[model samples]
Target: MKILLVDDEESLLRTVQLGWPEPDDEIVTARSFEEAKRSLLPGRAGDFDCIILDLQLPDASGTTILSEVRKRTDTPVIMLSAWGDTQFRADTLMSGADDYIMKPVGIRELHARTLKAALLHRKRSSPKPSVIAIGNCEFHVQAQLLKGETHTTKLTGAEASLLEELALANGEPVLRTDLYLKVFQREAQFGDKSLETYVSRLRRLLNEHTEDGAAAIRTIRGVGYRLVA
Candidate 1:
């Protein structure tokens, strides 16, 4: 089974991976929002049997990303937060989080909850359609496909998620925080290079097919990026 772990602390991530005694499971770590989004995109929802989300992200707040995920996929998500108040718990659960875990939590409990949520989601969820059109390109949400007028290419799950967000923005520049949270599904934090790497790969895959297509993804100085119409 594949597990997506979203957190910013490198040590915690290392601890989770090394501490997990499960011999047959894969634990992938995402240090920020963008990284999570890549792992949790619609078509790739089944890529991870379970998701462990951190609540105190630098970019996103409340259950915005959680709501977004519910719209596209039914993958089980367990939200982890430092705040352990009853109010917070009520808010998150009502907002659609499958489960809420407090910080300084026991690894054993976390694992148990993750397993339970995964099982429940798999049994209860059904398939949903996911597709988007960006200018001349058509994006298949679940298939990670991008078809353009003259060329077509298969995108990685992360690439497809990022492209979908950009396409939905419709030529406007999207905030780095929003893109990171929306695509990676975590906060945009310092020293996280995943977003840049994905964008470069996206530009290469998406622009190489057409004349001057490289200009389509424009850098917005100190902001984020804007997709050309």
Candidate 2:
């Protein structure tokens, strides 16, 4: 899994990077919101599965970034605060953060917390059933496929997941914040564009299977998206 570490403190960023998961796990460091923004562009951060963010920054508040992030992606945000106030924690949660941690936390504890948050978020987002129907189309979650009356087609992991989220919402608009959290596990960094790309791919594939074209998943514009029945 890929992780993005965002903080204004250079030493802290380096410390987290050095103590991060094994070599197989990729890590990216951003010292400011601008840097983080640049990193998550469309492709870079879109691929990341987790984000470790500091509440205070030299350029902008993490909450500011959180608001912006909620507009585009659903990747989990683990907020790190030096202040460590209970109100701050509550505020972070209210602002759409997945988890919050205080400074002076050990590497092992941070790792454990991050892992737990990711797992919980994934669990909460997962569809209850192995299969579900969306506008006359059946989706097999385990198989990652869409089945129609006369057609069956494979879907990419991301596409299947996006569809499943919409179908589970039962046509209600799933907020972009939730979508980013459920699908990407965290906010897309400055360079990550994979979210949009995957949506386009799913639209094309869904269009191929249904006469309604891509309208099954409607773009809510400035909000998020919805899967209509």
Strongest candidate by lDDT:
2
Which segments of model 2 are wrong by more than 4 Å?
130-229
The C-alpha TM-scores of every prediction are 0.52, 0.54
Per-residue alpha-carbon lDDT of model 2 for 1-229, expressed as tens digits? 6778898888887777788666576778889999999866765554667788888989999899888777667778889887866555665776788888888778778877777656655655665788776656777878999888788998877787887877767666777756665687665456676767877887777777777757778889877888776
Model 1 residue 162 lDDT? Answer: 84
Model 1 C-alpha lDDT per residue in residues 1-229, reported as the tens digit of each score: 6898888878888888888867688998888777778877768866778878888667775376677777877677889888867666755766677778888887778788888667655543544346665556666777888778877788877787787667656577877865776677665667998888988887776666555556778889889998874
Q: Which ten residues in a row have the lowest lDDT in candidate 1?
A: 120-129
Let me know the TM-score candidate 1 reaches against the reference structure: 0.52
Error of 2 at 50 (Å): 1.0
TM-score, candidate number 2: 0.54
